[model samples]
Target: MNKLLLFIIVFTLFSCDSKNIEQNREYNYPASKVWKHGVYSKYEARDLEGVFDGLEVDVIYSPEKNDIYVRRVVADTSKNLPLDEWLAMLKVPSKMSYWVDFKNLSKANAKQAMSIMINLLTID
Candidate 1:
């Protein structure tokens, strides 16, 4: 009887702790796209355009004008280091990816759009 009781007690404590751990990670919203992806800034927007020199700007995804906006991840230049600087400092080689996949995508067009997106989106 004591052994059975102890087993139940241990199981209960383990289940309780696991429940709390899972609940702690539940957040109210989807993670920000800018925060999760797009490694560019507003300042970089104008400058980076030069990286993709001679690219056209057009939206592949659009339901509304205001609905579709440039998605970007920006460094708090004053506080956070610039993206290029961070890339330079990394001890190990790393890569960052930006995307431009809409409902209808042309590989060539998407490539160009991604270029514009990278150049235009800012931290604000």
Candidate 2:
């Protein structure tokens, strides 16, 4: 009958629409505007809490204390920023991506570094 044919056509159209929606459901993240910027570093005089799309830093781990330090070189203790304080200084912690360049990260300090990053950066 005409009613049966109409019902089948409507169901087919809805099924195709649903399939199209599913195919376009992929998430699109925002692209970075700035290539690179400094968040906190001794070399730059900018504020430590400045807003940036990404952070490029050199990290060094202290074996004795099991703590992480941010510095260009491991020997330069004076310019080092502790992991906790550094995270606290970020203007937008959640929105920023960190490019951590671990300096002299030995196998002994690898676990400690991972733990420090997880504890500080993990959003509850």
Candidate 3:
């Protein structure tokens, strides 16, 4: 009778431990993971292929042309693409987000900036 009781106790303890371990294993890792990645100045249109979850572009208002342009320097004038044209070059994914850093815009240009951004973002 004592041997049978001991066997039952051991079996109960082992079963309880197994259940605890199984519960802990379920919480060992997260259900989902997120990654943040992007590019800097002078990034090519083709550079945004399957690698990034975001894009950061520097936008400066061109008072001369009455438009917004993307570049680190307004005076460099080498290979900078206007904001609309640059955005047109890439087919942005629905999941990807954009960080538009507006540079050197006056209060009057703010409305234009907002309008341009709204129009750009609402495009299909």
In candidate 3, stretches whose alpha carbon ends up further than 4 angstroms from where it belongs are 1-43
* Clashes per candidate (backbone, < 3 Å): 2, 0, 0
Better of 1 and 3 by lDDT: 3
Q: In model 2, which residue pairs have backbone atoms overlapping below 3 Å?
A: none
What is the Cα-based lDDT of residue 95 in candidate 3? Answer: 43
Q: Write the per-residue lDDT of candidate 2 for residues 1-124, one digit (tens) a residue.
A: 9999999999887777543454556643436655354434633312432444556777788887778877767678786677666766554567666677888787877877898888886642
Regions of candidate 2 where Cα sits further than 4 Å from its true position? 1-30, 37-51
Instruction: Judging by lDDT, tell me the better candidate of 1 and 2.
Output: 2
Task: Report, for every candidate in turn, its global Cα lDDT versus the true structure.
Answer: 0.37, 0.66, 0.64
TM-scores for all candidates: the values are 0.21, 0.61, 0.58
By the lDDT metric, which is better: model 2 or model 3?
2
TM-score of 2: 0.61
Ordering by lDDT:
2, 3, 1
